[model samples]
Target: MADLTFTKSTGLLAWPAAGGQWSARSGPFGLGALPSGVYAVGRNEVTDYTTSICAAFQDGTGNGFFVPIYPGFSTTRGSIGGRLGIHPDGNVPGTAGCIGITEHDASSFHDAISNTPANVSLTIEVR
Candidate 1:
């Protein structure tokens, strides 16, 4: 399985095996930064925006953090059941509590990991 690392300090998600990296913009006011730890990428699903793909961040105990985009609406911390996931979107407003990237980057990220079997481990380190 391929391993992915996200550094909160730089808002960058790195996939060494893929030989590339992408900028991941976290929530405004630091509300979107994921807790530094190891997590698993759960089932692949479509985002609320209906134009991108996403998956859940599992805490290794059946709990999931799903990231959803509200577009023009403001997003608050824990608004969506404290669920956060990786999705496609720019580092702009309305992403107050989710990690997002440009649509192009999102597609690249999705393609890199989407084929991985479920329960693939992904480590996120917040510094």
Candidate 2:
């Protein structure tokens, strides 16, 4: 059996604009440490101006699944500071942001996500 790990941390991340991209360094879950099909659930857009809770994951590829993990489907603005379930492959499938997982140098990507001042709660359960 593969070694599975579950780690949790708290910090903030900045969500870039449509043409921009941002990343968070969740715990010590390195780049390749997390399988390509990993899932992420937490707050996305955060700011005194805007906020949102989002859940996203991949299917062993870079294609990601994203959804509004907040109030309702119609509600698109809010902030979430709580424990989120991050699974390599969640038991059930639903609507969420699924993005292609890219394998990169762990050392380089580390601390990239939580480097922002927006403070958040992050959890990464690896399998």
For model 1, the superposed segments whose C-alpha errors exceed 4 Å read 29-32, 43-82, 103-105
Q: Candidate 1 has what TM-score?
A: 0.57
Q: What lDDT does each candidate get? A: 0.49, 0.26
**Could you give candidate 1's per-residue lDDT for residues 22-62 as a string of tens digits?**
77666654465555554444444432333232222322122
Clashes of each: 6, 25
Please estimate how well model 1 matches the true structure, expressed as its whole-model Cα lDDT.
0.49
lDDT of 2 by residue, 32-105 (tens): 22222223434353211111212224333322332222221232222323322221222233212221122221
Per-model TM-score on C-alpha atoms: 0.57, 0.21
lDDT of 1 at 62: 24
